[model samples]
Target chain A: MNSLDELTHELFTFFNGFSSWENSVIKTSELSVSEAHAIEILGTHGQMKMKTLAGHLGVTTGTTTVTVDRLEKKDYARRESVKEDRRIHLITLTQKGQQAFAEHHQYHSNLTEQILSVLSNEENEQLINLLKKINAEAF
Target chain B: MNSLDELTHELFTFFNGFSSWENSVIKTSELSVSEAHAIEILGTHGQMKMKTLAGHLGVTTGTTTVTVDRLEKKDYARRESVKEDRRIHLITLTQKGQQAFAEHHQYHSNLTEQILSVLSNEENEQLINLLKKINAEAF
Candidate 1:
């Protein structure tokens, strides 16, 4: 059995590597990391309330408001008030935002492809399964 | 074969889930996320120069100097001058910093243990090896 200490060390090493890789990729993009993340989330999950977007981003609503405002100014996203709730603003990505998201996503796809290239098909399946299990419990 | 889009989507979903999990864990810690990260990196890798620490933390050296200053004030870390180079300072964790690092490490270990509990011994080994391979190339 793998000791907890060993497992933790390995987990952290992988975490650090993954983060650095992501950072390097994000650095190449035109959008700031935060902006790219916001656009990615909106693109993937579709429109959400500003508060909900903040929650998903793990940022304060005020910070989310500022980011969304910037996105709006850049024509990357838009804020709309629902008929039932003027107090709540639904944030949606603009066509330009969708394009940015798609471009940014290509970076992730390329990285994932490179990472998986070394594994056989069966190994790839096993790896994905293990990640799925761990994520299910961890999340 | 997983299409690029499918692979990218899966990778991102897993990334989002992992980040959210880490954020929740860090939120419960006494130190701010950045502070905790500094201590964790120091604790993991031993003492380092401020520039190197900032590199690992993915922040500017000026930002790191400010953070190290706060950590120094809090008695979590200390800076020492080397005999050959008085201009260069090495930052090391204090006893308090080590304790916090240990405590924070427990959160990671616990999460890892929970995730690994469901996997078989062979599966665990495979997962670790796969992570190691990916990390080596990705880093």
Candidate 2:
């Protein structure tokens, strides 16, 4: 590849590295990263079917089942059979689960605060706007 | 909190969720995400000392030692004593290691191509620029 292509590739790799590094830090959370992600989805969407949750998490239903099993074992999640569809299991956060989600949110808030702390208020706003734009495009 | 505050909080959570999801996908690489990250850094810097590598990876020296041990065992990396500074160990990638890094790079290339397939050229450029800005601010 040419020099510019190589540079772009390097930048892309660095971007991914930053993301990987952030995940490593988040793994230090009380819950595993996948478990934490499951909680966040449950917390946001309220009760959701196992299949739906798996789709949202971009993992297979089997992986979601294992994650839910771990969360349920930890008392952070509960599964209820849907009345209309016995085959569908709806998962929700227990009170303990809600608390865990709140703490996890706080962790993210602190991280955002730390990241924005270095920038000016105007820069922070720009950063947020840019992130939103990028996310929209990514989706 | 007010509605705006709540919305901001939700945005933060969503951003973090996306990050976790991306990390999970990247972890599917042959190397763990952490190992992949270390390799990326090594590939960029050519060679580095154990302490420097540990500092760059944001892990304890002992943990870095373990990771390096595994990488070396897998023949992706090697550790050499510095002639001038015998106490310091320099780590560098072997040809096999470079091939591994190249393969990892190809993975990202495929991801980027997939992303671009769905996005306009302008949107792709915007996404890249936005990511660069965010990394500068966050790191």
Best by DockQ: 1
Checking candidate 2 for backbone clashes, the offending pairs are none
Q: Model 2, A1-139: lDDT tens per residue?
A: 7533543564565455545555776677778878988988898789999989998888899999999999999999999997787898889999999998787767656666655566666655555554455355543
Candidate 1 lDDT over B82-112, as tens digits, reads 9998889999999999999988888888878
Residue B64, model 1: Cα distance from true site in angstroms: 1.1
Residue lDDT tens for model 1, A75-102: 9999988999889889999999999988
Model 2 iRMSD vs. native: 5.1
> What's each prediction's TM-score?
0.92, 0.69
Give candidate 2's root-mean-square deviation (CA, Å).
4.8
List candidate 2 stretches off by more than 4 Å. Answer: A1-29, A115-125, B1-29, B59-66, B83-88, B102-139
Report, for every candidate in turn, its global Cα lDDT versus the true structure.
Answer: 0.83, 0.72
Estimate how well candidate 2 is docked, as a DockQ score: 0.20
* lDDT of model 2 at position B2: 48
Tens digit per residue, CA lDDT, model 2, B58-121: 7789999999998999888999987898999999998988987787666556555554665556
